[model samples]
Structure formats: C-alpha cells, structure tokens
Target chain A: MARERKFSLNEVFQHTKQLLLEHGYEGFTFGLLAERLGVSRTAIYKHFENKEEVITAYMVDEMEQVFAKFVHIHDYPTFDEQFRFLLNLILYHDDLHRMIAIGRRIPDTTPAVRANKERLEQFHERMYEELNQLVERGKQEGRIKPHLPNRIVLAYIFQSVVVPHFPGISLDQWAESIKEIIMYGVMTGN
Target chain B: MARERKFSLNEVFQHTKQLLLEHGYEGFTFGLLAERLGVSRTAIYKHFENKEEVITAYMVDEMEQVFAKFVHIHDYPTFDEQFRFLLNLILYHDDLHRMIAIGRRIPDTTPAVRANKERLEQFHERMYEELNQLVERGKQEGRIKPHLPNRIVLAYIFQSVVVPHFPGISLDQWAESIKEIIMYGVMTGN
Candidate 1:
C-alpha cells in the first residue's frame, strides 16, 4: 500500500526546480522541498537519500529534456532556420545555464550523485558535439565565413543567452533580435 | 624614522591583484600577501586594517585606471575605430572583470572598504555611460542599426570577453576576430 502512494518523480522535480531557483544550492533543503510539495519529508527520503541526490537527479532530468529537443534541430531545413530554432531553444531553457553551474558545485560524496554527475558531463560533451556539427553544417553550406574557427563561432552563439532580457520585449522578439545580432551584427550593412 | 618603510601601495596592489587571481577572494589572506611581498604583516597593517580594506582599495584603483583610459574613446573619430579601441581596452583589462566580481563579495565591515565599494560602483556606472555614448555615436553616424536597442548591443560587446581563449591564437588576433564578429558577424554577407 505504501508503494502505491502518489509520490511521483515528475512532481518531485517540479518542486526541486522551484526550490533550487529560489534558494540556490546551499539554501535548498529536503524539508523545504517537502513543504513546497505538500508532502512529508519521509516521502521524499523514501525516493532519495539526500538533497544532493534530488538536485543531481533533477539536473540530469533537465539535461535529458534539453538534449531530446536539441536532437530535433535536424528537422529544420537550412542553416538560418536551424540557427533560429537553436536561438529560441536556448532562450527557452535560460534557467538551465544557472542550474548547470549549480550542478558543477554539487559534492560527489554519494555514489548516486557521483554517477549522475558523470552522466551530466557526458551529456555536456554530447551537446558540444551537436553544436560542432551545426557549425560544420553552416560552414559547408557557405553560410558562415570559411576562415572563422568553429570554436569562436560556437562560443559567440552560446554567449547570446547571457545577454539579459530588456524590459517591454516578448521572448519571441528577444530571440529574433539576438538571431539578427548573431547573423549580421548591429551594422546597417551599407 | 618609521616613515622610511619599504612598503608601498603600488607594490601592495600589484601583489594583491596577483594573489586574488591565484587564490580568489576567499583563499587570499594577509599572511600570504606579506610572505609574497617580503614584508612583515605589521608593515602591511599600517596601511590597511584588514583584507577587505586592501581588496576594496585595489579594486577602486583598478577601476580608476580603466576609467582614465576609457575617457579617451573620443580620441578616435570613426564609430568602428572607437569601438575597436574600447574592445581592446576591455580585453586588456580582462582580469579586472574577475577582480571586480571578487570585489563585490567583499564584506562591507569597515568604513574605508565601504567607501571604496561605493566609488567602485560609481566607476561601473560611468563605464556604462561611456558605452551608451559609444552606441549613441554609432547610431547617429548611421554605422550601427538604429532599430537595435543600446542595451542589447552593449551587452553583446561586453559578453565578448567571456569567450574562451582558443589555443595558438594571439591576443591581437583574438581581439580582431571578436571585432569582426561584433561588426559583421560570422556570415559571409553574400
């Protein structure tokens, strides 16, 4: 009967994200998570050993979701279409960048968390590989300059998310502006 | 007389920067600083009450130096020329960005450090003012797109320094490439 409880990993991750965003890694606690989820601390403990386990699990889950969407970039045709799709995708997952940073600081004291961290690192490497392929595609199509290094081009694209959101702008407009800046820069093109 | 001491603020700040970069703000201590400077802790204490005071003072001094040079952006006539000058200066003072971040984390426990922190903040505001002026000039001269918001353009330029240094590339080349990317972007413009 205890195994048939409503304790779901999806619900747990939803609260985990909220607490992590609000309190950060150091401030996050199982007690706080339980309160937010409207469940007993024991319910959470039943699923995970500690806060690190929950956080690591949440981060891995987020990464997997992002990776799933990223692999779909091939569905979009042309370099510009793919680039726009990528810019929108990155902007949508803006919070994940902060979470990724927090993930790096998680201690590897527990075997579960350590294994999750290793898996997260592999996902990170694969993401970079995906980006590399995107750059290669752009170069092959002659959309990007031939002389520019793939790393620099890739870095420029990744840094776009760090640009803070300006007031009075919707997300679509913001992503469109960044796409324009990334492709043609601020020049008038005279 | 006691006035005839080898301890100089210039030497102190130079070593402070090195130590902060090496060990970060938390790892830095007066003992390590004194040992590296070949001076007694008492000698250093004569000039500073604590580590916070030293770090804050060094940060203010660095900001002032950068500000002094930044005011000369008007020396260059063209918009692109001024932009390039600003880019190189920002890149040259790249370590200052990390130091500025460390400066923010210093506790405001002393009057001297607190005063320095305020002054450092003023310098930060003035730097942004300078950047805003640069963007205004570009727009007025019809070089940069008038449709682009100044904040996005400025953020894009500032974020350029965060790009990792690719191996085998000199600083001059790196700055040049970034300048190109900022002005023309990676597109071939065909």
Candidate 2:
C-alpha cells in the first residue's frame, strides 16, 4: 500500500529540491530527508527508489523549468531584449550550471547518460536555432550586427561565460557588460 | 628498500596520469594502478600514501610545466603571440578538463577538498595575477582591449575553457574554435 503520509509527491519533491540546493547531491541522505519532512525513510523509498533517482528527478525538473523560460523568451520585445535574455540565460542561471555539471561529471560509458545526452543535445540545438533566429531578426531590424555569422557568435558567447560559477552577478549586469564588449565589436544600435 | 622495478619513476607516473585521465578519481584503483605499472601494490604505497597524493603530485608537476612556459613568453615579441602562448599553457597542453571535473565533483563540505581548495585558490590567484599583467601589457601594446577588466575576462575564460572535464575532450585541436572566439573577444583592435 502507498504510505498514507501527510505529504504529497510534489511537496516531497519541492522539499527535496530545497535540500539539494542547501546541501549538495551527497548530503541529501534518505534519513535527513525523512527527518526534515517529518516522515520515515521508507516514505522516501515509496516515492523514489534511491538518492540517485531523487537527484535525477530534481535536476531534470529544474532543466524543464529553465527550458520553459527559453520557450517563452520571444514574448520580450526587441532583439536587444532577447539578446540580453540569451547571454543571461547562459551565464547566471543555476539550471544551466547544474545541467552542464551533470553532463560533464556523469560517466558517458553508461547507457543511461548516453541516452540522456540525446535529449540534452536536442534541447541545446533547438535553443541555438532560436537564438540564431533572434540575432538574425535583430540584424534585419538594425538592432544587432549583420556581418557576424549566426552560429559562430552564438557558440562564442555560449562558450565564453555559459557555465558561470559567480552566483551574485545578475543577468542584466553581465549582459550589459558583455554587450559593451560585443557592442565595440558588433553593431547593435542602441 | 625501494622496489627494483623494471620501469622508471617517470614510467610509473605516466601510467598513473593516464589511468586518472581515462578512469577519473573514482574509477582509479590502487590495484589497477599497480597492475598497469607492473609493480606490487605495496610498491605503489611506498611512492604515494594514497591515490590523492599521486593526483596532487601530478597537478604540481603539470603546473610547473605551464610555469616554465610563462618564463619564456617574453620571447614571443608580440602580445598576440604571447596570448597564444598563454592560451596554449592554460588550455592546450594540459589535461585540464579532468582537473575541472575532479574539482567540481568534490563538494566543499568534504574535509580533504576543503583543504585542497585553499592551495588551489592560491595557485589560481597567482595565475590570475600573472594573466592580468599579460593582458595589461597587451593593452599597452595595442594587442588587447583596455575597456574590459582582466579579472572578469581572464577569470571567465580560464573557468570556462582552460579548465577541463575528466575523460572528456583532451585534444588541443578541440579548443581551436574556442581559442578563435576568445582571441576575437579580447583583441584590442576588434
């Protein structure tokens, strides 16, 4: 029978994510999670098989939320705004760092990570296409520079500061700084 | 007495570094290391108190090689040439991705890692100071931009690409495209 606990699945997940953020992957023990949630260790197992399962669930859920933000980015007016969004999305967001860390640390020898890489790469490629289109639109609208190749610039910015370790820096701040550098290099008419 | 091994210390170290590169900190075993080096595990113990010691030694050796290059950078005669030398020192010649992966995977809560981080941070600071000097000199020579702060630009580049993931891309040529991006971004004339 399902542990007729006081907590719901989403509630447990939310709590687990908080723990993962407060503590890291290793610190999220079943005992502490159970104690923190005012439930037995068995209750956690009822919802998830292992710590790996819970951590994986949390990371993927976070990734989905980040992807959701990317999907809705076009809602912003102006390529300059969208450009700001792209640079920020790569730099300060916790989701990007978490995902990239997961990608790098997890052994690719495993079938599990290899399979996961497919979805991850697909998501990245789609996002790149969206960003490329945004820059293209900016150029046509006389906002971004026309001469720089779409993919090259995208990869340049992406690789430059994508997996940021600095937590306090804001997206607008980083975007503005990089925009000045790129502004000197590229023509993004303010 | 030290084991009269057929292989030299250099040979043993080469094997150890290779094993760490392929398998990572977790995957590497004392038994496996001995087996690859064609020595008894006891002999290995004589050389390194633990695997961590070996890894630490490897890093120290690697940094020494990089530092040796730094001394000769003045020979290059142009800031761009010097930039290329610095780039190769940090990104090209090192198995840096492995070190980065190892660094990220270890939580600061771990006692060993916490202690290791102090030394690592000091090393990073020294390198950063030297790099800032290089960039500043480049600016004076009109080879690198004056507008960007060396701390932000060099730190970002070092963190992003100079660093590496264990068992990931180890080839220097792999970073050619990234070097191109950074070259353009930091160039004064751009």
DockQ, per model, reads 0.42, 0.18
The C-alpha stretches of model 2 lying farther than 4 A from their native spots are A1-42, A104-122, A132-153, A162-175, A179-190, B6-32, B35-42, B97-123, B141-143, B160-176, B186-190
- What digit string (tens of lDDT, one per residue) describes model 1 on residues A4-105? 766679988999999877766776888898888888888888879999999999999999999999989989988888887887888788787768757877
Q: Pick the candidate with the highest lDDT.
A: 1
* Per-prediction fnat: 0.62, 0.07
Docking class of 2: incorrect
Structural similarity to truth (TM-score) of each candidate: 0.78, 0.70
Please report how far candidate 2 places residue B161 from its true position, in Å: 2.2
- Over B115-183, each residue of candidate 1 has an lDDT whose tens digit, in order, gives 999999888888899799889988999999888888888877776676767888776777777778888
Worst 10 residues of 2 chain A by lDDT: A181-190
Candidate 2 chain B, run of 10 with poorest lDDT: B181-190
What would the per-residue lDDT of candidate 2 be over residues B1-190, giving only the tens digit for each residue?
Answer: 9546666767766776788666656667789888987778888876566776666656655655666767787788777787877777666555664475564554454454455566666676777687888888877776666665555566555644533333444454346534654655322231
